[model samples]
Structures are given as structure tokens and as C-alpha cells.
Target: MRQGLILVVFAALLPVVAASFLQGQSALEDARKLAFERMIGTASAVAERQRDPFVIGQHLLLVHATNPDVTDMTDTCDAALRASLSSYPPITNIARTAADGTVRCSAIAFAGNINLAQEGWWQRGVSAKGMTITKAPIYGRIAKRDVLFLILPLRSGDGRQNGTLTAAIDVNYLRRALHDAGARNAGTLAIVTRDGKVVTDSNNALAFKPAMGAEPDQPIEARDKDGTMWIYTLHKIYSSDLFVVYAEPRAQLMATAVAQMRAGMLLPLISILLASIAIWVGTNRLALTWLRELQNMSARFAKGDFKGDQARFERAPEEIAAFSADLHIMADVIDRRNTDLTQALEAKSQLTREVHHRVKNNLQIINSLLTLQSGRVREGAAKEVLAQTRARISALALIHRLLYEQDNGYDRGEVAIDNLMAELCLQLRSARRSMFQVELTCHARNFPVPVDYAVPLTLFVVEAVTNAFRHAFPAGTRGAVHLNLDLQAGDAILEISDNGIGYSVTDEAGQMGTELMRGFATQVEGNLSIISSEGAGTQVILKFPLPNMSITNAPPLGSVPAF
Candidate 1:
């Protein structure tokens, strides 16, 4: 009974404890104000130093132009006054005009010349009242920067109004000085008139907003709707309506508000009770004991065993729903690819046998025609024509025989370097009626590739070799035909050299198939170089990069192809 009474007393006292914590908020506000005031104090020190004396002198000069003695619209006194300003120290630019709005004389840097009659600041200075200060304007091509010019009416010994004195103030220097004062350069110091004309800002020292004319009701920091306290303070410059404002955001200013709130925690039971209710309403996963069979169904789908379907995706946790959708999409793609592969194989099989049958029948008919044509012709030209026709027909017949011997057709039109060179020599021997003998030597290793990749490459090699035989070793010259083929850097390399009274390789290579040889190489996306050294026989190296050789792993090249 005593313990229960003690617990009740503690709960009842928690509100009072929280209220005591709120009371310290006033102290936090005091600290914030002190810190902001310190920052403003620091920034003001540097700002004063940036106001150059030359700038201050021009300010007085602009105001002096309003004096009545300035009646000479274009007076020599204006020139004398300007010369005096330029001759004096701390002044970069100066201009003055009479109260009637006429520029009298102008002086700038000792080495500078500026026309005051057409200037905006000159006109404004002439029209300004006693102590009017104009917002800085970006003017003049000389230094072409934004500057605030002060205008003060000149006063004679009797206190009469004379011409005005104008002084140029560069705001860019003032802004940078403020930035150097703080960490973020977030402090803002403004020289405001009775109106809200923000004369100078720490950020855009030279920037003057168009609406900086005047403000009747200005912002003062205090509590917002959230009941947070803010601090805003203003200091009026001595003997002037201009106020310098210093302020900061309340939330940012108060550093100790959070520590005080945490130290004030009195009761944890209420917070715990609220947490339990939130957990019960939000969680409904398997731990809630809602679905057992659905788990088994999703497990099978995840393992890619989608055949035996179990429960639908109705009871899995929200996190697993996206995965379930992906399973359905994959099943559709696999089924479609399988059907396409099967149909394509069947069509390919039927077309292969048909092509073999038609090619064989065409070769047999051509051979019979050549035989009959040779019998009727008696002239040497007629017999040579029939002989050439017979040789072409035999080559076509060889193509058919190879096709029927393989299910893959890889050995049909496609030929490896070793096998291709041997076959070309045998066929050329049969086709040539000359007395000279032709020898074929093939030196190459097993370079595996697809038929599409090998066929065109072999055709290019065949053309290069034949051109050597028919034209290179002419007129019964007993010499050797050399063929060297290799593979390097995903490319098929072949070198065909011939030694047989080889016509100055340079001149002979320049004619006939030498030109056609380039076209044949391009057919296979390969390269052909006729590297023939004078009488040392013609040597041709054909480089063809094989397909599917992993170009991604190819060595970095010094340059790119023309294409």
C-alpha cells in the first residue's frame, strides 16, 4: 500500500517538474542576445575600417554642391573646389554642381578624367537636400563598380547653403570585411534611414536592391506562432536617424534549450504506453501468426522452382511483394526464348539439305554442258573456254561435297588457315594447264570460330593466293609459292610470298587484283598490306580480327580506326 501511494505521488509531480524546466528558457534567451551582440560588435569594428577617407571626403563634397554660391552653373569655383579635393588625401573621385542642377567642375584620380555632367551620381548630388545619402549605384567605366556617394550641402561662415560636396564610397570592400569577421559570414549589418533603405550589406557590399527606399514598419524579432523567443536589437548612430540592426534566428540563437528539456524528463511510463500501441497497429507480419502456407509458396518461387505453385502472393510481408512480381516476369521471358530456339533449329535443318541438293544438281548439269561444248569446238580458244568452265564447275562441286558431310556446315564454306591453303593449291593445280609445278605450304594452329566469321576471311585469303599464282610467277618460271598463316591479338594473319621471276613486286603489285584485293579484304572487315620488297618476291599479310574474341578485354590502342 505504501509503494502504490509513492508511485501516485511521483506521477502527480511530473507536470510541475516539466514547468520548472520551461522557466530556464528565459535564461537561454539572455545568452542568445549576448552572443548576437558580441558578433555585431566584432563585425562593426572591421566595417568602420573599410570606409576609406577618400570616400568620406567625396560624401561631403556632393552635399556641398547645394550651396547657393554654386549659382554659377559652370563656375571656375567648381574647378577650384574639384582641384582641391583631388590634391587632398584619401579622395579617388569628386564631382559638384549648383542647386540649379548644373555640373561645375569634376576631378578624379590624379591620372584619371571623368565627365560629371552626364553622370547619375552627379545629378542626384546636385538635387539632394541637406543631409541626403543615396543608395550605391554601379557607375563609371573607370573602376566600374557599385558605390554609395554621400551628398552634403556646403556651408559658408554665415551658415548659408553653397554648392554640394560629393564623395564616393565603395561597398565591395565593406562586404568582404564583414565576411572575414565570422565563420559563415552570416552576420548582416545594415545602415538604414528613417526609411528602410539598406545602405550596406555584409554579403552584397556593392549590391543595392531597387526597393531600398524606405520602410515605415520593419521586422522586430520576437516569439513566432511556435512560442519560440527571438532577439532583434537596433542602435541609432550618434546624431542621426540611421539605425544599425543586429539580430539572429531564435532557434539558432538558443543553444541550451535542448539540454534543459532533456534534463527535465520526469516520467517514462507515459512514453512507453504510447510506443506499445503504435507497434501493435503497424505490425502484421508472420510473427503476427496470420499466414503459414504462404511462406512455403514464396520460398519455392525464390529458389526458381516455379512449377508447383502454392498459395497466391496475398499474405507475405510488404517487403517481399516486389520480389514475387519479378518471378512472374522471368517465367514469361524463359518460355518465349525456348519456343523461338526450337522453331529456328527446325527451319535451319530443312534449308541446309535443300541447298546441298540444288547445288549438286547445278554442278552436274554444268559439267555435262562443258563436256558437250568441248566436243563441238575445234579452235584453241573454244577448248580453253570449255576448260575454264570445267575448272569453275569442279570448285562448285567441292563446296557441295563438304556441305553434305557435316551437320554444322562449319567445314563446308568455312575453312581453317591450314586446310584452306592446302585446298586452294590442289584446286589451282587442277585449273592450271601450264607445265610449271605449284607447291603449297600451310603453317597455322587451331583457331576456332563460327562459319559466318571464317568464310569471308577464307575467301579473301584464296583471292590473294590465286592472284600470286596466275600473275606473280608468270612464264614457266620454276619458283616457290610460300604461305604462312598465324593468329595474334584476336586477328587471323596470313603472309603469301612468291619467288618466280616476280615482276618488280612494286610495279606488278600496283596492277589488276592489287586494287581488287582491297575490296575482298573489306568484305571480311579485315586489312591487307602488300609488303613487297623489290625483287625479293611479293609478300602479302592479311590481318582479320576474329568475331566474339572479347573486344572489351582488347589492349588499349594508341589511335582509333578511321571508321
Candidate 2:
């Protein structure tokens, strides 16, 4: 709660701090403007000294083809221009050509003669109207310098083109000029064409760094490292849209703004701290009241008063408002849950009663079928079959009885194999006491098979035992009937063996019982194997896959075929 109060107070004070700092930035801007103005003035002075359009024009106008005292300008006049311009420290080499399409170049300061034609700077000036001017950036081999070749057209007083004169200007001299104009700063400054081509820079560190694309073209307004605001001032040279820059750094000025911000936050922080203390005290009182109410409400619920409200007289501070709302919602939810529980209990009771009634009805139907079949029997063999059928029905009836007695009928209880087998044998022995004796053995404990699977399995066992008795022991012959039931791994294997004469799989001539056994095994999702030799016993093993999913531990009642 105290932490929350502190955060709220801090949020309210943060804006005052931001605005105070912004004020210092405003002052810094004014100072930067003043600083750049002085730098620009200095830059302008250096530019004026280098400006000489007329002097350049006159130097070009002095040459004429008819003035014999001077050399014929037929070819060498252009060479003379280059030589003359090279004499100045600021120039390296120059070239010239008449407007009539002739050109020359030279290696000496004013004497080494060479001739060339159709020069770029000469063409630029001649193609221009009147006494046109042009400047070309070039890298000169002899001068070993980056220089600008300036071409000026010499014209008659009436503006007729006589010829063109050219001069080369040293770039280093321009950098020196910008140096005095306070160009020593972290960021670079350069003179550039309006097209973003760099002509010169104060430091010349990145001699030809590309200055175009997504940066400010004119003066730039931005904040500095210390959040001190300032502006950049730019100047354009008159003739060619060439530009220069002056920057004013302003970090020191923003400290004033930082001071104002600290001052503004002081009052709000103190007030918030005081407010937090008061809220802390109020929340402490309200929390104790809520805890006591919770204790009383839980006690009432323990006494079975589920309808009692959980928390009342609610007085929650903002810090605990969310927790209080969640508690109230929880109580409303619990009240709804109790009502649902009562309805669910009554529904469960009705379902159990319905299941019991259905089971009784089903058992009656099985008994009726058994009674009707027993009444229709005439011959001894027929009566014996009827009695066996009755025993099979009883096995099925017992499964239903077990299901209805258990809590969750479908999933619980196993048929006791020993007891089920004992009863089946007795029923068989009573119907017909042949010389054949039936021996049943089980190795595993009793386990459940779901009613659906166990019903078919029970009937299958009865049919196998009856078949062995009726057919395996012939007249004046004696043999034993061995039936073994086992639960192993994933399947319950039922092996019924008889010392009867065996037959081949292909010889189904009179083997109705064998075929039927195969069908029954398949019906219960199991496999049947018949092993028989003339001298050895015939063993029929039906691997009835017990419900791998379900089992119940219950004591076996005598050895019997369990459902």
C-alpha cells in the first residue's frame, strides 16, 4: 500500500520536472542564435576578399588576335590563360578556348605549351548567353590538388563573345577561411552545391562524404546531448547556390532548466509523502475490520449456514479495492454452487434407483427363456442341452446382479472363475453323469471383464464344456476333460482340452462345435487355437481378451465359469 502511494505521488510530480527542463532549453536556443550570428559574420568577411568578378573579366578581355605585340591567340591564347592562373598560390593550372571551339593546356606556371579542344569548362561558358561564367571541379596531376577551374567569357563592349579565360582555385584556401569562422566542433561543416555536392569543408576529414538523403537541407532545429535546444544557421553564396554552415552548442544553458525542474518537484513530492502516510493509517484500520468479518463468516458456514454472506461492512482502501471485489465475487459464486449441489444429489439418487429396476426386469426375461426351453425338451439329449442352456442363463444373470450391487456398475467387480466353474460342472454332472471327469484349474487372481465382454465369454465356456462331454468320451472309452482359465499379460486365455480324436482344419466334415467355437472367439475380440493329434488330447484355447481397462478384486465362490 505504501509503495503504491509513493508511485502515484511520483507520477504527479514528473510533469512539473519535464516543463522546467524545457524552459532552460528555450534560453539555450536564444544563446545559440547569438553565437551563430557572429560566426556567419566572420564567414562573410572571408568570402568578400575572394570575390572579384570584374577583375577576372578584365584579365580575360585583354587578349586579341590582331594585337601583334602579344602572341597570336590562334591556339596558344588558351594555354596562356592556364599558365597565368597557375602563377597565383590559390590556383594550380588553367585552360582556355575561344568561343569558336579551340582549346589548350600547359604544365609550366605560364609557359609550357600544349593544345586540346572541346574542353568541358570552355564549352559551359561559350554555350551560355552573354559573358557567361562556369566552375568545374577537377583533379590536376601536375598540381596534385583538388581544384575548381573557373571559366569567364571575355566579350566586346556590345556583349559579343571574343574568347574565354579560365583560372584554377585551390580548395585548401577555402577550408582555411571556414576555419576562422568557428568551424572547430564535433559535427562537420561543409560548403555544398544546392544539389548536395560537397565543394569544401573546414576539416576535410571526410573529403567527399555524401551529404544527401533524409537529413535537414536548410537550418536544423534539434536538442543537444544535455537536452539543451539550439538551431543551425546556413548561408548561401550569391552566384551558384553554394552554401556554408555555423553551429552553436548549448548544453550549459539547459542546466538552468534542470534546476527549475528539481525545484518544481520538491513541493509535490513532500505533499504526496504526507498524503501516503495518512492513507497507510486508514488502510491498516480497514484491513483489520475485514479480517474479523471473514472469521465470523467462515464459522457460520462450518455450522452448515452456507447462505450466510461472507464479508460485510466493507471499507476497503484503493490499495485493496481489487482484492475486496474479488472476495465479494467469490462469495456470490459459492452461494450459487451450494444450490447446484442440492439438485445434483437428488438427481444421483433417482439414477441409482432406475438402474436397479432395469436390472431386475432383464433377469426375469432370462429366467422366462430358460423355463420355456426346459419345458419343450423330450429326448435325454435334448433335456441335457436345455439344462446346460439354463446354466448359461444363470451365468449371465449373476453378471447383472453384480453390476447393480456395485457403486459404478459398468467398471467394478470381477467374476470369480473358481466358483462359476464349480457351479457349471455340478449342473453338467447332474444332467448327465458320464464316465468323463472335468478338471478346471486357474493360476491368476479373479479380475473383472465388463458385462458386455463377459456375457459372450460365459456362454462360450458352457458350449465348449458341453461339447467335450457329449462327443469326446466315446462308448466304452475313458478320458479326462481339462479346462484351464488364466489371466496373463493383456489377455485371459481359456484352454479347454479333451482326450478326443482330432481333425484337420480343412476337414470340417462333422466339426460344427469347432467352427462355432472359432466364431465365438472372434465375436469377443479374441483368437482361438485348436491342437489335436490322434493319440494326444485335443486342446482348444480361446484367448478372450479380458477388459484390459477394468478389474475388481473379489473372492471366488467354488470353481465355476464366471461371467
Candidate 2: tens digits of C-alpha lDDT, residues 124-224? 76556543333435664445677665555556567777565555556676667656543545444566655666666665333232333323324455564
Instruction: Give the TM-score comparing model 2 with the true structure, all chains together.
Output: 0.36
Model 1 stretches astray by more than 4 angstroms: 1-333, 356-426, 429-437, 444-459, 471-479, 488-491, 505-511, 525-527, 531-535, 544-563
Instruction: Please report, in order, the local distance difference test score of every candidate based on alpha carbons.
Output: 0.53, 0.56
The digit string of per-residue lDDT tens for model 1 on 314-381 reads 56666444555565566556556656876886577557756766786788788888878888999675
Identify the leading candidate in terms of TM-score: 2
Off by over 4 Å in 2: 1-379, 407-436, 443-448, 473-494, 497-510, 544-563
Among these predicted structures, which one has the highest lDDT?
Answer: 2
Model 2 superposed RMSD (Cα): 18.0
